[model samples]
Target chain A: MPSLIWFNEDSLNPEHQMVKDYADAPKVYVFDAPYLQAQNIAKHRIQFIYEALLEIPSIQIYKGETVAVLLQLIKDLAISEVVTTETPNHMIKGWQNELQKSIDLVTYPEIFPVTDHSSPRRFSRYWRKHERSWLTV
Target chain B: MMQQLRTDLELADREAIATYLQSEFPFVEDSGELSPHVGGRTAGLVRLQSFRLEKYGKQRNFLDGEVSQLSPYVSRGCLELEELRQWALKQSRSKSVEAFVSELAWRAFFHLVYEEEGDRILKDMEKPKVPMNQHQRSLPEDIAAGTTGIPSMDTLIHMLKETGYLHNHARMYLASYVVHFRKVSWRAGADWMYSLLIDGDFASNHLSWQWVASTFSTKPYIFNRENLERYAGSLLPGDPKQGDPFNYSYEELAERLFEGAYMPEPSGRSPGQYQ
Candidate 1:
């Protein structure tokens, strides 16, 4: 089953370590109209996204509902699964739920290491506990 | 089908894309020369490779410091905090790297707060230790127009509006001045700054404003003339001894600026103490 890599603003790097296995996979980057409207992202930030997309190879840019666009692409390309990098956004989580019903949706871990312990509300407390692990190498 | 749609855009460069977006979305401001540098995975990687951590640590607080202009990449997720940390660790064993690493930790901490609290981070993280006057909700017109008599702040506003970037120290100073001196709500100041910053992350921008406003921290972060002279003297226009309003001692600054809402009471322990 050929997979399609979906690139969002948070994970635009095509050469990300997680995507190495799917190096030859066709990638799609969507403008995510709903997300943009919700976020109220500035023009400069949007420009940054456009410039980044220009760097990656064979990435199709779409401006619409994410799930609808992905579903149509899956049908058109016969894509068995959609792989994307995980973001902390709640909207992405909702999109993933809708997406999983029709096709396989695989999310790679964040670029940073996730801590096992619950993060403290204060930065000092968080840093005191995680600094050693973070700085160890 | 998707391929055909992309083929139409395949020939488009950044300028064409910007033009198309601007025409389609009227809210999108024309960035002009203040347009942020082109960011891609390859460019971000190259920037990371060339960053000088030692110089960054030594002078990052100064206006003309050797700051790594990598925040746009970091905020956009082109570069990761963990990746930068690993690079710093490999490059040096000096304490300078500790300063740089701690800064990275701050970014990570902000993200952690945002992750755990969600939209709650938009409000005060904790009840402010001091009494706070509920201030205006909107950014002042003068501040927005970059005509705020204060030299350093006016320069920062111009820079932020034009470049979509301001040095972190300059950000802190501007944020502190807006929230504390102007008595504006941190939210207003945060929103204004967030709108222009190319590297704006809600977690960092909002929480940092809260920190400066004393909503997120024990004491408000304040800067005086002497402090500005030490860090941003080179960037300030004209003589400090002339008609500059910022040219005042810490005690005078505290008395004049805070108006008894907050004051720097001298303690026997330290030469310069704020209470």
Candidate 2:
């Protein structure tokens, strides 16, 4: 089975909250690296995740890192499919493009289900306010 | 950097406290002994909450000691805004009470923007549809010093410098003046505010500065001397009728109607992997 991982940072959305909110129950893993100093943990984790992606070639990663972090994470994870709620702020858009080179990225508009949304569209072309009937799908 | 930042950071914290006091308690003159409100201490909160029922709304507009000084605490999470929102909603279900709740929601919204956007909220990415001077202007020390020579703004400058607090109205005024009258970049003002406001969360200050600069909001924010005098009239002591009721000497009003002044800065460069 393909594994799904949630990178937890305890922002407005945390791992526990993500587990509850996300409709699909993917295999959840919390990346832990206590051996590294607190300051280096984030960077080390990215490096670790990247190395793991190269070896396993089966793990799928979902992320919420800062834009800069996401850039490196995408290359490291070798992610082929991304599913996330739309962000009005553009940093996440940057991550979507980086992953697009090799993987499939999908996003549900913030006003989900009601908003006509389609996966695989880049943020720039992701039009706002699609027809209601299409969104119901 | 710590030593260089020592005074500025201290000033920031002090200003945050000051801003909270000024906004919440415009009537109190003394900064007497008060216990910590957070870290398991409830003394300060209890004392602050004592005035919540009366002056929280009634004296909010009064510049002196009429409002609640809890904003900095709320902004920095020293005090939970959700608690305040719930308390206020319970106290009075009227529009006035709801207004306070809405203000708290705005803080949450600012945090949400940053939580979702991260550092990109600070970057300028959107290319203005209309071309103009692309140069960035440095922030003025006087403005930062709150010494722009505008009498009406003196309270704001004094609050920011001496205490670290600026009235909510004062914040709107100063931000508008800095972004419009002074024609300074919102980033500079925001940076200076962050450096000096203890309660300065990246989201709240940044978005608010942009809001007043008309960079984040669709409408241009402005304040005239008459408007200021009218709002703050009853707050000043003794001779409430004092000061210019119509006009005050400050930057002359202009009608340039600038564009591309309200959009958020763009996030980092987008990746090439489009669907």
Candidate number achieving the greatest DockQ relative to the actual structure: 1
Tens-place lDDT digits, model 2, residues A63-82 = 22333343444455554444
lDDT digits (tens) for residues B1-275 of candidate 1: 22223424432366777776776556665657536566676778877777777787677778887778888888777877778888888875877687777778777777777767767778888876445666778889999889987767888888887777888888988887887678788888997887778787778888888887778876677777777777887997644456655566655665666655566656312111111
Off by over 4 Å in 1: A33-40, A65-68, A71-80, A90-104, A113-117, B1-17, B34-36, B238-245, B251-275
How far residue B170's Cα lies from its native spot in candidate 1, in Å, is 1.0
lDDT of 2 by residue, B1-275 (tens): 00000112121243344444344323333333221222111322654566554454555554654556666555433345545655665664554564455455555556556655567767542432222244246678877555656655555665555444566766676676676666677777776665444354567777777665544544446555565656665542222335432243222232232444332223322111111
Q: In candidate 1 chain A, where is summed lDDT lowest over 10 consecutive residues?
A: A109-118
- Lowest-sum lDDT 10-residue window in model 1 chain B: B266-275
CAPRI rating of model 2 = incorrect
Q: Candidate 2: where is the Cα deviation over 4 Å?
A: A1-137, B1-44, B54-62, B124-136, B233-275
